[model samples]
Target chain A: MADVPSMEALEALLRRLPGIGPRSAQRICYDLLVRKRNLLPQLATALERAHAAVRFCERCNNLSEAPLCAVCKGLHRDHSLLCIVESPADLRAIEDTGMFSGDYFVLMGHLSPLDGVGPEALHLDRLSERLAEADLQEVIFATNPTLEGEATAQFLADLVPAGITISRIAHGVPVGGELEYVDRGTLGRALHGRRLLDE
Target chain B: MADVPSMEALEALLRRLPGIGPRSAQRICYDLLVRKRNLLPQLATALERAHAAVRFCERCNNLSEAPLCAVCKGLHRDHSLLCIVESPADLRAIEDTGMFSGDYFVLMGHLSPLDGVGPEALHLDRLSERLAEADLQEVIFATNPTLEGEATAQFLADLVPAGITISRIAHGVPVGGELEYVDRGTLGRALHGRRLLDE
Candidate 1:
C-alpha cells in the first residue's frame, strides 16, 4: 500500500512533545485530520511561527520573540526584586498569580551533568552580568522543588556575586507535585512563606 | 519588570493546537526555551516547511505535499477496494495494524445533526465525485461504532452506486469501545467480524 506520507510526518512531530507516545500521537494525528485538518496548515504555520520567531530573553532566559522577554522589557516591572524560574512555563505560572511585580530570569532547565549540562549550559553568566548592575536588591529562586531544581537554585545562589538577596519559591507544594499542577493558593502560600537563603 | 515578549508570542501560537491548554502551551514554550532556546528557531523552520508544503491528497483527505495524496498517486495500491473512514486518525489507526491492502477515502467527520453537520457539511459530494471515475469494487465503512457513525454508514449505503458492495467495520470493535482506544486484537476482531449494511 502506498501509505499516506502526511500521517507519518504528523506522528513524528507530535512524538517530540513531553508526554506523547505513539498511540497518543496517532490519536492527535487522527483528530487533526478529521476535526482540525483545515487547521493543520494553520497549526503548522503557528508551530513554525512559534519556533522560528520566538527566542529567549537574552538576559532572563525566558522565551521571547524579541531580544528581551516582555517581563525583562517592561518599564513598570520591579527591577529591585528578581524572580528566577526553571522554565518559561514557570514564568507564566507566576505571572498568572498576578501578585509578583518583580521581573523574571528563566533558567529554562536545571543543571544535569548526566546530559553534560553545566553552568555554561544555563544563562548564568548573562545573569551575573545583569545582577552586577547593582540595581537589584532581592532575587527569588522560584525553580520547582525537584532535586535538579534545588541544585540549580543553589548554583545560582553561589554564582550571583554575593551582593543580591537570593531566595527560593515556597515548597509547600505537596511532594511530587509539579509547579505545573500546583494551585494558586498553595503557590501563593509558598511564596508568602519564602525562607531566606543565608548563603 | 521587562517581560519577555517572544515567549508571549510563542505561547499564543502553541495555544492553537488541539488538547493543549494554556498551562500545557506555556510548558511547551518553557521546555523549548529551557532545552535550548536556539532550537526554537530550528523548530520554526520545520513548521514552515510542513505548513508551506503540506497539501491534501486529491482522492483521500490524507496530508500531502503534492496535489495528490501519496496513497492516491501510488500505482501499486489496490484502487479496487477503497476503505472509508471518519477521519485521518482512523486511517492511521487502521494502517498501524498493517493488515489492510486498499487505499482510503477520509470522510473528514461523522454525521451529527444537532451540530448541523450533514452529508453536505462533510463533503459527501466529493465522495460521490470520486466514486464516479474510480474503479472501486467495495467500500469498507470503518467509522466509529457510535450512533452518529452508524447513521453515517447507513446513509452512505444508499448513496453508493449499486455496483459497489458496501460493508461496515462495527462488528470488529467492541460495544462502547472507541476505535481510538481499542486494542489491536479487538479492532482486528471488529474488522474481521464486519457485517452487511443492507438491513
Candidate 2:
C-alpha cells in the first residue's frame, strides 16, 4: 500500500502538541492506527467538544464554559485574598495544596523579554480592571521563581495601588528532597530564606 | 468553571492513549485548550480521518489503506524470501536496515502462554497456506530474542514442512556495544555464533 495519507496527517498534528517530538508522535500515530480503533472516535469527539465548548473565564482567565471560573464564582472563597499565578496549571497546583482559600487570577504567561512577551501579551489591562473592582486586601504573587516570573511579579506589584499587602510563595528545597541532590539555586534560596524554628 | 466539562472529557480520552498517564493527559489537554487553539481542530480532523482511512494490509498484515502492503505490491521485492516479525514497528525497523529486500509476514504479537497467545493467535494457518503455494526458498524469523519471541520462532520452525529452509535472525551483542557492559546472555550468544575471519 501507499503511505496512508491520513496517518501522515495525524502524525503531523500530534507532533505539534507540547512535549511530543516527531518520533513519539509517529509512534503514537501508529499505535492509534494499530491498537486503538475503539478509542479513536471518542478521542476525536472529545477534542471537538472541548474546542467548541471551552472558553477562557472572563473573570480569572482560567478555562471555563461560563463568564467566571469556579474559584471566581465560589461564594465561600475569600474575595479579599486574591492570588495571582502565571497559568491555569499553577492555579490547579495551588488548589491541590489546599492551603489557599482565595480566588485566583491566571496571567496565562509571564514577561519574557527575549521572547517579546510583555505585560500587554499577558493582558495586564484585564488584571487592572479586576483589582479596581474587587475589595481585595492581600495580593499573593505565586508566579514561578524563574527570571521572567520574577519580573512579571515585580511589574504586577508596581501596578497594584498602595496599602494592599503583597506576598510571594516560598522558594527552597522541595519536600522529600535530599540536600546533596538539590540544585545550587534552590539551596542558595533555601539558605537565604531560612526562618527560625517554631520550637 | 468547575472542572470544565469538555476539558475533563478531552483529558479522559487522552489518558486512554498508550504511554499517556492522567497527569500528562491533563497537561496536554490544558495546553491544547490554552495555547494550541489553531491546532486543535486540525488535530481532531486528522484523528477522525486516520480512524476512517487506515486499515491493515491484507497480504502482510502491515498498516495500509488498500488490499496489499507496499512491499507485497512491489514487483522488485524478493517474494521468495519472507521475513517474520512480531509487530509492524519491527517490520519498519528491519526495513530501516535496508539489507533485507524480502516481503514480510507480521505476527502482530509474540506467543505468550501466560497472555493466552498461541499459534492460533498469530494465524499460522494463513502462513501454512502461503508456504504451500509460494516458491519461497527462505523464511527468516526476526522475532525479538526474548523468551516469548524465541518460543514463537521455535513454534514457527516446527510448523514448516521438510525441505524448506528456516532461518532465524542472529542473537548477539549489538554493534558498537562494549562486551564488558553487554548482558551475559547476549555476550554468550555473540561468542557462540562467532564466524571465522576471512583469509
In terms of TM-score, the best-performing candidate is: 2
Task: Give TM per candidate.
Answer: 0.69, 0.95
How much of the real interface does each model capture, measured as fnat? 0.32, 0.76
Tens digits of per-residue lDDT, candidate 2, A19-41, equal 78888787787688777787778
- iRMSD, model 1, in Å: 4.1
DockQ of each: 0.26, 0.70
Query: What is candidate 1's lDDT per residue for B53-124, written digit by digit as tens?
Result: 655677788766677865677677887888888876677678778788788888878899999997886677
Alpha-carbon lDDT, every model? 0.72, 0.85
Error of 1 at B148 (Å): 1.9
TM for candidate 2 is 0.95
Candidate 2 ranges beyond 4 A from true positions: none
- Backbone clashes (count) for model 1: 29
